[model samples]
Target: MKTSFVSNLAIQSAMRLTIQQTQAELLKRSQEQTTGIHYDLGLTLGATTSRSLNLQRELDRMSAMKSTNAVVTQRLSASQGALETMQKAAEKVRDTLVTYKGNDGVDAMKILKTEVNGALQIFTSAANTSFNGEFLFSGINTDVKPLAEYNSVPPSAAKAAFDTALTNYMSANSLTDMSQFTPAQMQDFISNTLEPMFTGPGWDANWSDASSQNMTSRISASEVIESSTNANTKSFRMFALASVISSELMDKNVNSQVRNTISNAAFGYVEQAIAGLNGERSSLGISESRVKKATTSLEAQQKLLNTHILDINGIDQIETATRVNTLKTQLDTSYALTSRLQQMSLLNYL
Candidate 1:
């Protein structure tokens, strides 16, 4: 038999390497046991790793969309509340006009004027409402206020333009007092001048900074909806015109005939405003429903993708735990053997 000489140093080095490898395996199996997933996905899944990566990427995208949809739902809810506020104010004015129509009594006229002014303030304030630091009714111009306050100090441009137009109309007609204002004259001025002021470029220049186009949001991969309304719509214009006419002329010294005409016109405009605003509310409600449905669909897809990813990368927890325990025992035995080797020195023998 051939005898080979092996140094204690070489045996200790081999034991040290074995201990290190055993500890590394123990750590890996422990992690897999705790997490119930493979410690190294690329190694275990091999060629299927690409499919797992793709599924995980799609799942992340759906998660991001769900977060975005939450913000969109909040914005839409806030917009709906603002529209309700405007609608309530308009309804108050409508009720006042209907209750006190054709009555030129001092108390009734004062009440009518107060309600009209209050409605205008409420309408403008609602239209200029902001959410998340952006104007809800400014459409694409989210940073800009939609409607200027009509009763501001020194008067807003809209008020100034309206005053100027009235002054010019009075001068041209040579009317000394509003009581001398005839129904024919008032109707002509309203149709030819006042209506255009509220509905034309004049409104953009003086009253509203809102865009005609509304804000739209993507609710799903293939679906988009308008998430906001704008103050530049015809409904908003009609509400402003009705409020202006009632505020400026309702308590004037005009005869009952002209006052009745003015009341009738305002009543008609208010009715239209109410109907149009309701339509806008309905449209937003539809968008809210679609957002909810899209969220549901995304959640279902996310659950399915998550299951697929787990199937690709998941480990058998019971088997992993058994392997981990076995590695721990081996590592402990190796540690003991290494300590024994370290102590087996020639000095100890001496």
Candidate 2:
């Protein structure tokens, strides 16, 4: 064939382009083999872009849930510890009071008084407990301390009223002996006077915890959990009443009959308090277990989502290696051809 100048130049340009294209292909495949993910994800995941993006978004949400759940779990754990400690203190006082019931010894009452005071302090301190600057027992009022300090100077108005009523009632009745007081009279004093102080307007006035509302956290797409407990529950009320009555019983000015009646009341209240505490602990335990299970499930889902994303965009190592070798051979062949064509000329052909 008699090749024209323009035709020969066009052939050489086409050969050079072919060699460059093959070299680029070799580089791409080599990178794919080394990285496993495609060098050009947009091209590799062309049709599946939407699916992969959705999966990634879901995974991100799951990760975020895990992080928040960790914080919730920590707070719940701290609350649980405080509850258990308070429970133990209440139980110890209950056992001692029961042991010394009806003894009426001045020395014994003194010891029991000390124990009751200690239990009260423990319950109050636990109620005011905080985790990471948030009050654990304040329900949604995380920023507020849940309980008043047990012995505030000058006394709370409610405490002052309580102190005066018990003293005046004892003096007005002219009953110096606790045996003169009936359980019904003590019940009247408690229901009409003291219980209201712990559970009704006085409690609301002094404490910062919400009435019954629990804090909730959403740990997954389908799961929401009560992440906090409040201080105004029946358990706390029972504990408060028991602690207060026991403290009252310790007053030597109160007749033995009054002390005995108060001790009996304290016994009943402490027993009920223990039962209530157990129930609260069980409920919180179940909540914790559910949160943990949800966390584990979310983690597993996140792993699966990552796998699916890799499936959409990841390269097969074996296939990438084979393609790299093949592209290298093609580029080598193209280079050899281009070099030979470069060396060739009309003079050589002639």
Candidate 3:
């Protein structure tokens, strides 16, 4: 067997190239190695990783939705609390007025009158309940002060009754699905709630500033209230508080007769408000439960996704080390063979 200079050089070059290529490939594989190039290993891990990425995106959306819902829920609960407090106050006034049966009924009326004024103040304050700078009872009028400083001109009766009742209703019944109040709910509030109050006894020309600030804050309701079946309804909910008014405590404080009127109206109205609040609270409870369930569901999906990612992108240290060792052996063997081949010449073989 004879080898010339060109052939010898060629043999050495070929061996060096083979070793370098193999080493490079081994290193690349090592960096991103996983199982299943071997038939024994199934694609579960890879599939899991792929699934994980998709699940992660969904979870992100869920997390964001849940956060917003939390804000709404807190405001709602606070509004409900305020309504409950007003209801208690109204009940007290009712008790006091009813007790003043005969001649002392005038006294009863007097006490009732004072009580009614106090209760009205409390109720109005509740109407202005706020959360995160937004009024909970302002019917989305984020900037509108819920209760204008006790006004005398517009005869506070209409505004007071309607505003309290409507806000209480919105606070309780406001669907966590904000979508229920869009394009229609705002208009409904204006026409049904605001217009009625404005046109009624509370229509004072001076409170126009108060009237101008309704339905002020909203993005797409559907953006928050999305659902698989359909979006939330846009109908305005009427609470009992709006329907009943104690004109006794109109623009200014009143006497015993007015107290009796307010006492009679406050109880029925507050009872109605309570019922509405409970209904809305029940709905929110359901949503909270669903959100919790979704969180668990997403967490489950995350596990599968992680497994898939491991299969696709994560390295299998055991298998990688094994394969790399094998390639290293082959490379060493080729190097040795090339060295021998390069050193050989015709004279040496002879």
Q: Evaluated with lDDT, which candidate comes out highest?
A: 1
lDDT tens string, model 3, 1-350? 99754667777787788988998877765554544232222353444554545655655655565565556445545655765664565455445445542222344445655665676566556556666786654553455664543434765554466557556656866634323444344445445655455444343332222332232211122333211110011101122232234323221233434333344444445454545545544554554455455545645665776565445445557877888788888888987897788668778868
* Model 1 agreement with the true structure over 46-114: per-residue lDDT tens digits: 899999889989999899999989999999999999999999988988998999997999888998999
Cα lDDT, model 2, residue 285: 86
User: What tens digits encode model 2's per-residue C-alpha lDDT throughout 1-350?
Assistant: 78755666677899889888888888888888877788887776787877877887888889999999899899889989989988997897798788877777878878888888887888888878899998888888888877765556878654676677777776777757655666666767876778777767677766445546878999789988898888888888888778877776555545566567777778888898899888878878888998899999998888888888888878889888888888888888878877877887789878
Select the stronger candidate by TM-score from 1 and 2.
1
Score each candidate by Cα lDDT. 0.90, 0.79, 0.49
lDDT of 2 at 49: 78
Ordering by lDDT: 1, 2, 3
Question: Which one wins by TM-score: 2 or 3?
Answer: 2
In model 2, residue pairs whose N, Cα or C atoms come closer than 3 Å (at least 3 residues apart or on different chains), thus clashing, are 177-257, 178-256, 178-257, 178-258, 179-257
Best by TM-score: 1
